[model samples]
Target: MAYVITSSCIGKKVGECAQVCPVDCIQEGEEMFFIDPDVCIDCGACEAVCPEAAIYPEEEVPEDEKRFIQLNRDFFHRD
Candidate 1:
């Protein structure tokens, strides 16, 4: 499964995740960075480097933070 970036990253787009992402699926939004689910390789590389600890596996995302899974998708699919 793809990884999701949670609210902890909303205002602190440190972007460490982006640097380590081998597939470069992370993209900076206005307030944070989002993972392009379709492109993520599930390598967990970005999650390991996130300074805010904001990244989680799709199925493992916290209950309250689960919305981020869709938000990550929305960020890439926005029209």
Candidate 2:
């Protein structure tokens, strides 16, 4: 499963996760960073480095941030 970046990342573009991602799957959004699930290797590297603890495994995404699951997936699927 891929890791999902949630709303906790909003207004908190710390970028540490992006810096450590081996696949370069992380992309910048208007207010935060998103993990491209199609490209992500599930390495968990980003989760270790994220200062906001905004990263979670897709199945483990918090109830409050469930929408980010689709948001992250959609970001990569969009043209």
Give the Å shift of residue 41 in candidate 1: 0.4
- The local lDDT score (0 to 100) that residue 24 gets in candidate 2 is 99
Off by over 4 Å in 1: none
Going through the candidates in order, what is the number of backbone clashes in each? Answer: 0, 0
Which numbered prediction scores highest in lDDT against the true structure?
1
Which runs in model 2 stand beyond 4 Å of their true positions?
none
Q: What is the TM-score of each candidate against the true structure?
A: 0.96, 0.94
lDDT of 2 at 33: 94
> Clashes in model 1: which pairs?
none
Cα lDDT computed for each candidate against the true fold = 0.94, 0.93
How many Å off is the CA of 69 in candidate 1? Answer: 0.7
lDDT by residue (tens digit), candidate 2, 22-48: 999999999989999889999999999
